[model samples]
Target: MRSEFERRHPGVRIQIENIPGEGQYVPKLLMMFVAKKAPDVMHLDASYASVFIDNDLLLDLTPEIKSDDSFRLDDYFTNVVDVARRGDKLFAIPLDFTPIVLYYNKRLFDEAKVAYPAKGWNCDDFLAKAKALTIDNHKEPGKKQYGMHFINWMPLWIPWVWTEGGDVLSPDGRHAEGYFDSDKTIRAVEFLASLITKYHVAPTHSEAAAAGVDLFRAGRAAMHIAGHWMIIDYRSDGIDFGVAMLPTNAASPKTVVYESGLAINRSTKKRELAWEYVKFMTSAEVQKVRVSGGLAISAQKEVAQYYASDEQERTFLNAVEFASGPWGARVEPYAVVEDLGREMMEDIVNGTPVPDAVHKTCRLIDLELSQQ
Candidate 1:
């Protein structure tokens, strides 16, 4: 990224700062902001973008994007633009999006001789294939292979609900109103839980982390439900795998995708300069480079075309077309809603009934939204 910046603008200099992980990103950035030494530009999760924007810390890039006659906003994906929206205002433009994909060990499938999931395949196929890959502890006790592994995170689970034609919040985003009470939501949670409880095809969060992706890397689990970020890790391990679209019920085939984008610090004196850098970062040319380098899935249609040469890349891009909104799905008071959802998810995964967990989460979400 720094090289690209330097090459493009000879007179300008670039400095790249490395942050440890997603967990520490915000608090550290917030400290920088408090010290009035925030970077000219920074990448932020769409979920947490509102925090900086709400505090008037983000520069409104609308004028720069509009005034620049060369900027064509239509080139980017609609969902990317939609996610960056803050109450009808455009504060930032998306650089890339991370779409969820179901990765399976092709070698394991070949060994088990189970069929691969095609583009139009549904959850029924997923279950059948997973079962075929799963070996019962008592029967095939020699091998400790499971069918699949989920992150046990809500971001990963949201798609299951969406596939069942359910969401976390109401249309108006005013209150949760028990969206989880829907049969669709219940069924989705049940299906996910059954992989562990009934089929023995998946492990709980603790077990998976202790084992790590080594289970999948060693072809233990036939399939893994994960995001694009796993590409680097899997690639480094030199495993033979195939990325497939996230499975869904035929009735509602839209998969769920999560994303984040870059926002310029409003307090920066070089607001115009920051916008220019942001514009360049999200442009098709730059985005294409980023995507081709396996950095991210660019939001621009033209940039997204860069992934066409690779089969898994192509699979992920195609999956985005059927993608649904993020887990919380609402824009306002995102942190509160996300925390509430996370707590409920942990409760249900730890053995609480789905109905009780859903009800509790919905009530908490309602209260949070009301406070907002």
Candidate 2:
């Protein structure tokens, strides 16, 4: 991708710094900025973009957007484009995004003679399908089937809580007092726990660990809640899969969007060139190449349609309209929040009272936020 850009600017060299893992990228990038040696252009994830933006280490692209008459912001999905925006200032042009959705095994649903999931299905409908699809093979234990796949990852499961009108943080990202331990949140937490413990449709944490593989990908589970990125592996495994809007208990569906974009350093000497580079990377022509691998839904609406060869892919495009940005996109200490959420779930699954677990977790989350 860097080579493609360098070819356009004959004398210029686009030096790419590849940071290899999470928890390291932001610190390394921040150090570069502190030392006045940051790169002109950087690949930014919407989740951690807040750290850089809050410190004013990245350039606001609003002026460039106004000056460039040929560039069109309408080309991209509106939800994703707003990820890097803070009031009047825009920071990045979205390259791609993945909205969290429910993935189901078509083969399993057919085998169970269960109807496929449809949009606007409620939590009751989801539970009924899950119950029907589950198979307990006491004789052939290795061939047992589960209705749903459960993972304790907070980000992946938060949408369920959201659909129930519960959240871990306030709208302004201030505190978690009323949100995380509220009556609605407690119900959401207990309901998720019941899927594994009481309903026995989803595997327990210990059972999943014993399996040592992705139950959904391995065809041992009928339903999984995840983002678009899982499609690559599912297709490679030859699994006939379908995507659907997550079941909601509220008036509407709610899901989180994880996105990646391009940004310019505030100190870059080649400001205009950096802006051009950002535009080029997010251009529909470039996005077409990027989404061919099924990595993510292109932020460009037209490119997303071009990328969608089948109904499964089209569902992702439809989902983009209802998805909202993740909390990590704006809250700097969200990693700590995620840790607490996981711990709370673990406590519940291991015999702790749901109310007690939520109360403890909510208090810890507030303490973590106070430190920030």
Candidate 3:
């Protein structure tokens, strides 16, 4: 891609600067800003866009987009593009997106004589199948197979709370006090932990560590909660998989839409060059190349429709309307909130009482928010 971009513009090179780790990215980017050495173009992730949007680190692309006759903002998913927008001002062009969903192994379901999971299945239905599938092979006690896979990732599990009418932060993204510790949220957290501890349908953290392989990817788990990105891994492993919406007890199902985009650094001296690069990267032609590998559903609707070859891809598209952008897009200090939430979940999984963990985590989150 970099080579192609350089080929189009003579003597102008695109220097790719990578931060290497998610933990080190923001800090290093900030240091670059202080040193007046930030790149002309940056790959923007909507999951933590607030860290840039709130600081005015990105240029508003609205004018550039409007002036360019060949491009239209509506070409990409509106909800995704709006993640980096502050009112009428736009900052980024979406590259691709994915919504968290339930991924089930068809082979496991068939072998166990269990039915495939459907979109509208509730938590109760999910639990019943999980329990049945977990203990289906009664003849062999030595070989173990799990029904689902659970991880300590807060982003991955946040949808479980949402499906139960719960959330971690208050409206307007200012607080986490009452919201994080609310009864619904507490109940949701407890239910997730019970899958590992009480029902034994999902592997515990230690078990996953001992296994040294992703249970779902290894085909030892029947159902796993994940996003579209897993399609690449599953396809490579030659596993037959299907995607389904997260189950719900609330009025409607809920999940998070994570997106990535390209933005021009506000301080870039070569603004037009950067804008051209952004436009090229987000074009349908480029998206077709990127989407071919099943990494994510394309942000470009046309490209997305063109590449949605099967039911799993179609299911992911059906989820876009109901999916909400991650709170990190709105909340500036969300990385801190994510860490606190992960700690709370880990505590519950390790035997701390759910209420106690919720209360403790919420208080700590409130303290941190107050500092901000």
Candidate 4:
């Protein structure tokens, strides 16, 4: 990737540094910033942008975007653009959007005599099909099958909260709104839990990791809710499954999305060059490489559509329309917000009330934002 990037632009050196996904990135960037030696242009995960932007370490490229003839603002999805915008100002341009979808085992559906999920299917439809796919051990003691396999984690389940008409924050971002304790939120959480306690369509969290995707690979589970990143892995496994849009309540929006992009370092001397590199990265050329290469959902509308030429990719693309940024989706203090989500997920897995969990998370973030 670096070789190709460098080949495209002579005299421009590109260095690829590997780092762990979670906490490692923030401290590393912070140390570099302290030394005033942060990279001119680099790709960062969505979660770490808050710290960098908060410290005034990222360049403001809004004017450049507005004035540059070569940089077309209308080429990408508005949701992606909104994600990179904090306080009505652009900090970065989204390189890709991550949409979570439902992957169903065709063979399992056939065995259970359940129909495939159509694109606009609703939550009731999902529940009915899930129940149909669920197999009780009493009928087949040696071979136990579940209708669904859930992560017991919120990242995997956030869509349902949205589908139930709940959200993480108010439009103004002043207070916790729909997501934590709303009726819709409770309904979503209960529905998710029913897969285990009531319907018996899923395994416990521990059971899932020990088993991994084997259950789906072996036709033991009817469906799995996952991000677009797993398409290649599943394709490699050679499973006879199909991808579909996540089922939503009739009253709710029909989509969910997670996006990440590139921001220029404000502290760098070469701000114009840095912006150029970033501009190029989100442009159609590199976006094609990213999407077609199965790396991510490209921010470019054309590139995203091109990647969706395949059936599986089509399902992923259709869901992008209904996408929402994570709570810390655009803000610079995303790490702190993400940390709150992580803690809330832990509480959910530990049997805490969903409202309480979300409330606690909200309080923590509110405190952090106050401190900041």
Candidate 5:
């Protein structure tokens, strides 16, 4: 991409500095920003765009997008594009995204004589299949297979909240007073907890870690609710897996969407050149190259068609239509919200009353938002 961009524009050179991982990427970028030495063009996680925008550190791309005849913002998914905006102004253009979906082990379903999950299955259907697939030691000595595997992460659990018709914060993103502690949200937490404490269909946090194997990859769990990034790794491992949309609950089916976009530093002297690079990076040619290589779901709708070689891969592309961005896109102090959310889940897994955990976490989130 750098070579092509340089070829397109004579006398202009592009140097790429790759950051290893998300853990070190954000801090290093922040330090560079503080020193006014940040790159003219950089990638920003959708979750942290609000923070950079709040700090007035990101360039507003609205004018450039509006003026460019070749860039049709409507061609991209509405929700994904919305994540890069703070009201009417766009700060970046998304390059790629991955939406959460249901990944099931076909071998396990066949062995249990259970039908594969169909489209638009509800929570009741999920529970029934999970119960049927779970195997106890009495059934088979020294081998116990769980029905589902859930990692204790905010992104994994937030879909439960959304499916149950609940949210972590208010629509205006000001407070979490009633939303987080409401009956619907508590019910979601209770249902997730039931997978461990009540139904015994999923492994506890400690048990999963101690097992030293990914339950889904090892074929010890029948279903895993995760993102598209796992497809390549699972395929390489020779696991017989299939994909389906996340089951519906009280509301329509929903899942969390994660995306990374390219944005320019607000203080850059080379705004024109940076915009050109951003346009080229998200262009159909570049996106096609990325999708063909199985890197990620491309941001362009036209380029995304390259990945639909199988039904499972097609399921992932279809899932993007209904996926919504994470709560951090709207709420400030999202790190605090994420930490408190994980802590609340841990409390539930440790046997704290669901209602009590929800109430306490709600208060803590409200306090954090108030201070901001």
Candidate 6:
């Protein structure tokens, strides 16, 4: 990509700084920003865009987008573009995105004599299949198998709340008081918890750790909920797995998405050059290369066609249709809210009553929101 860009514009050099890990990526970028030495263009997670936007650290690209007749923002997914925008102002342009999907082991389903899940399966179907596929160690003495595997990650279960017609915070992103503790949210949380406690279909954190981080790859879990990033690893491990959309609820079918976009630094003197770089990076040619290489779902719908050759890829593309960014991504001080959410999940897994945990989490989130 760098070579291609350089060839297109003689004497123009693009310096790339590769951040090795997610742990220190943002902090280092923040340090650069504070020192007024930030890059002309930087890649940012859609979830973290709010943090930079709140600080007025990113350049607003709305006028540039509107004036560039050759650049059609409408070519990208609406939700993806919307997430990168604060009101009508564009802060960035999404490069790629991923949505959570249900990944199941074909062999496990065959062994259990259960039918494979289809694209539009509902919560009831998921529960019934999970219960059927689970093999208690007591039943066979040596054999160990679980129907599903889930972790404390918000993206894994937060979609359940959305499908149940509940949200983590109010639409205005002001408070979490009523939404987090709503009946629908409580039911969604309980349902996820019951997969471990009541149905015994999922492994606890300790049990999962003992088995390994990739339980589905180890053949210990039949179904796993994850994103497109797992595709390369699963394929490399030779797991006979298939992808399906997340189970639907009575209200709707929904899934949470993670995306990254390229934004210009507000302080950059080379604003036009930065916009050109962003445009080139998110172009169909670049996206097609990235998506076909199994890096991520392309931000451009036309580029998505490059990944439709296989069933699993097609399933992932289908999932993009219903995917929505998490509310936390749009809220200010998002890291604080996300940290509290992780703590709330830990409390729930530790056997705190769902309502109690929800109430406590709501109060904490509200406190943080008030500070913002």
Comparing 2 and 5 on TM-score, the stronger one: 2
Cα lDDT tens digits for candidate 1, 232-340: 8788888788998767775546766677677888778777667778888888877776776576788888878757678988888878778755633345576677677
TM-score of each: 0.87, 0.97, 0.95, 0.88, 0.96, 0.95
Question: Which pairs of residues clash in candidate 1, taking residues 3 or more apart in a chain or in different chains?
Answer: none
> Which tens-of-lDDT digit does each residue in 18-88 have in candidate 6?
87886688789989999998999999887677778778899999988988998999889888877777777
Clashes of each: 0, 0, 0, 10, 0, 0
Cα deviation of 116, candidate 6, in Å:
1.9
Please report the TM-score between candidate 4 and the true structure: 0.88
lDDT of 2 by residue, 110-145 (tens): 999999998799999999999998999999876679
RMSD of each: 2.9, 1.3, 1.7, 2.9, 1.6, 1.8
Model 3 earns a TM-score of 0.95
lDDT of 3 at 30: 77
lDDT of 3 at 240: 90
Error of 2 at 138 (Å): 0.8
lDDT of each: 0.76, 0.90, 0.88, 0.73, 0.86, 0.84
Q: Is candidate 2 or candidate 4 better by TM-score?
A: 2
* TM-score, candidate number 1: 0.87
lDDT of 4 by residue, 1-372 (tens): 567767877898866666678667778877887887778876655545556665677777788887888988789888767765677677788898778788999988888788999867887898899889988778754356778887755566778878878765566654554445567767777777767766777876666666655677677788998877777777788888798878878554555567788887777777777777788788898788767757578989888887677788887776776776665554556555655766666566668876676667777766665675
Q: What CA RMSD would candidate 6 show?
A: 1.8
* Candidate 5 Cα errors over 4 Å, as ranges: 138-142
Question: The CA-based lDDT of model 1 is what?
Answer: 0.76
Segments in model 4 whose C-alpha atoms lie over 4 Å from true places: 4-9, 138-143, 177-179, 212-214, 250-252, 331-372
Over the stretch 1-372, how does candidate 5's per-residue lDDT look in tens digits?
778888989999998999898568877888999999999999988776677777888999999988889888876767777788888888889998888888999999999999999988998899999999998878653356899997988877788888889889999888888999988899888998999989989998987887789988988899998887888889899998899988888546888888888999999999988999999998888888766656568878877776677998788788887888887766658877988999999989998999999999999999999998
Best by lDDT: 2
